[model samples]
Target chain A: MQVATFLAYLVAAVLFITGIRRLRKPGTARSGNTIAAFGMVIALVATFLVVEVDAAWVWLLIGVGILLGGVLGAASAQMVPMTAMPQMVAAFNGVGGGCIALVALSEFYQGAAETWVAVISGLLTVVIGSVSFAGSIVAFTKLQELAFTGSVVFPLQQVLNALIFVGILLLSANVLADGAIVEAVGAPFLSPLVSLYILFAASLVLGVLFVIPIGGADMPIVISLLNAFTGLAAAASGFVLGNYALLIGGTLVGASGTILTRLMSGALGRPLGKIIFAGITATATQKGDQQEDREVHDASPGEVGEYLSEEANKIVIVPGYGLAVAQAQGPMHDLMETLESRGKEVLFGIHPVAGRMPGHMNVLLTEAGVPYDKLYDLEDINPEFDDTDAAIIVGANDVVNPAANDPEQDTPISGMPILEVEKAKRVIFVKRSLSPGFAGVDNPLFYDTEKTMMLFSDAKQGLQEVVEAVKSA
Target chain B: MEQLLVQLAIFIIAAFLGFELISRVPNLLHTPLMSATNAIHGIVLVGAIIVFATADDTFTIVVGFIAIVLGAMNVIGGFWVTNRMLGMFRPPVKRVRKRKG
Candidate 1:
């Protein structure tokens, strides 16, 4: 039975690797998911078989928990739209953290931490798991569009975060030291429960503060960070429980989440640490005087369509988060097809942080039946924007801003890489209004009359009208 | 210390293995890949099941119950949602399946 259980775990681990590998391509990704789910089922069944349980109430609790989880899980997946996938991901990952924290706490109650290794691991789980849970909840809220999605900055926010980090470490060190040496002296060394609770509370507070000032578009970074935290926490839970599956599985998640974080931050033309530590949006508003406003010409969709119907070498469409919200990808694709049919070369240029999630615009455009080859990432397409005849920006602001290109001013997004749509001979912005983007910085591209024009309308409406006008022209 | 060594070995091996495994995913499939990995990590459910099954006290039972609930939810919701998102990425020809009206 022992050998069989270990074999099951081993198989599950292999399957997880296989699943992730197959997820690279659209053709095999679905099967990869199924295989991984099967592995999970086997791991779970083996775990239940190996653990000795005779009590009927415990069995009852386990059954009830599974039933409740199954119902809620199915309901959420069926109900939550893909647009809300970010929030759902945040919320579910948060639950994983909360669950792991509970596992650590319960093991502590069961005296599983009799050894120093176990004691330290248990405390680590409690701290990291609590933070992941709290941070994920904040990320979920920021993405859910429930209320304000803007940054909530305050005086000395970094100082407060540092203080909280120090507080968490001091509390954790005290608990572990008490469990290790002070217990030998036998003077009611420490209430493990009290210290654990206080530690969890402080970590939870830190998680909130850590994510509170982050704006909506940056939630992807926070979600990735929290996901990594939960992974390490789960591994720590493994140490508490002496379970190899938990340890291995959790570490895999931690490492992968970390890699994804670096990839996402790089895509946005910022370092991972900068996105997390510096609330650039908050500070940029304080130094907003540099953007001297200039009047922009308002062009009708008919005029833009006439321009597209005319002789143009190349046109690039840059879609951002607003494209997702407006459900305009389909019409945008129609416009692209129309443009192509009229003997014009049309391509898409995507900024790394163009959408709320990593690969947000890519997945969205692909779902709208756009081919992979036409969609060029920032580096590949940045040079082409200058040679292009026109660049139509659909409800995006900061990614195309010239501010990122200008390094002398030291603006919040100064070092960030942006789509040089302004370099195009003629640029058109399709937006509902002239509002500042999530970065809260003015985009000079919208105000430049010689090279830029604003099509002040909904993305879908603008695209549809433009497509119709092109057909008529 | 020996036990911790095994744990550390498992940790490093899994990290390298995961990085190698997931690095090939195309940018277009990133959303699905993320959701899929999220489901894979929901393997935490196994730990919750073990804890809940072995727990003795009422408080432990309560904690185990909550953990199991959350773990199961994470696994189920994550996999289902990932599948739904990936379902949207079918090629143009086969994207439209026949509907029984």
Candidate 2:
């Protein structure tokens, strides 16, 4: 029986690794997810059969838990709109972190960790897991706009976080010392349980403090980092239980997440430490307000459509989170089709960090039935804009902002790579206002009257009107 | 102590494998890749089951039960959402071609 259980775990780990390997390409990604879920089914069933249960009610409780969780998770996953994916992913990650924390707590309550290694691992799991849990919940709220999406920094915020972190460390040490005392004397005088709960509470607070100061623009990196933390916490729990499947599976995700976090921050031209420690300050917001009075060129969607149909032969569309917010993907697709039908060549210049998450714009465009061949990456499309007829920016600002290239300006997005949309024959922006993007830096591209035209409207209505005008012209 | 050494070796090797596997992925599939990995870590449900099965006290049992539920949700939701996202990446239908021709 023991041999069979270990064999099953070995097989499950192989399947998971295979699935992740297959996920490298678009063609195999769906099958990869299915393969990984199949591995999970095997691991779950083996767990149910191998675990020795003494209470009949425990079986009933476990059954009910799986059923309820399955129904809720499936319904939400099936129904959530693609635009809300970041928050949905955050919520799911939060619950996973919560589960690891609870497992560590239950292990502590049952006195299941008999060795020093298990004790240390259990403590580490509780701290990391709770931090991930609370931090992910904060991330969910920020992405959902349920709370203030800007960086929230009180006076001495960093100092307060440091103090809470130190407190958690000291409380964890006290628990370890209490456990030692209990082992030596065989009697519990000062219980470790009290110190353990205190450690958990402090870690939760530390998690909240860690995430609250990060602005909405940096959510992708933050979520990736927390996902890594949860993975490490699960591995720690595996040490407590001597479970090979948990150890292998959790470490795989931890490594993958760490790499992704690095890649995301690198794409934004920000160091991971800078994003985490010195949050983008209030200076960027103040800078945007200083330019509020500057007059800029504005045009109607009809004029822009006329320009596209009459003058532009080649067009490039740049999309951002606002396009998703306005639910304009369908309309944007319609406009693309209209241009194509009129014998205009249209392509998409997709920035790496164009939307709320990595590859977010690609998924949204693809969902609107855009062909795979129409989308081009920043490196692939930047040179194309130089001789292009028009660069129509749909609800995007930062990626097209020229300030990123100016060495004299030291803004939050300085030195970041941006689309060279300004170099096109004509620039058109479909935006509601001259407001800054998530990084809070006002774009100078909107003010270039000779080369740019701004149509101030919601992205959906703006794109729909453009489509109608193009059809008529 | 011996078991600890073996587990540590496995952990190190798996971490390296993960890094190598994910490093090659292109920018287009990143969100789904993240979501898929998020689901893979849901194997924490195994640990939750062990805790729940052995609990002799009400507090431990209650905590274990919640852990199991949350872990199940994480596993189910992570994979399901990933599948949904990947399902959106279908090639533009043949109608666009027919219309153009």
Best candidate according to DockQ: 2
lDDT of model 1 at residue A222? 77
Best by lDDT: 2
For candidate 2, list the clashing residue pairs, or say none: none
Q: Could you give candidate 1's per-residue lDDT for residues A397-429 as a string of tens digits?
A: 888889777766665677788888887889989
Give per-residue lDDT, candidate 1, residue A220.
Answer: 82
Model 2 per-residue lDDT tens digits across residues A418-471:
989998999999998877887778888887888899999999999999999899
Model-by-model DockQ, in order: 0.58, 0.76
Model 2: lDDT of residue A156: 75
Look at candidate 1 and tell me the lDDT of residue B29. Answer: 65
| Candidate 2 residue A91 C-alpha distance from true site, Å | 0.8
Against the true structure, what is each candidate's TM-score?
A: 0.91, 0.95
**Reference-based TM-score, model 1:** 0.91
Off by over 4 Å in 1: A155-163, A177-190, A279-284, A290-293, B22-25, B92-101
Instruction: Evaluate all candidate structures by whole-model CA lDDT and list the values in order.
Output: 0.80, 0.87
Off by over 4 Å in 2: A179-190, A279-289, A292-295, B92-101
Worst 10 residues of 2 chain A by lDDT: A279-288
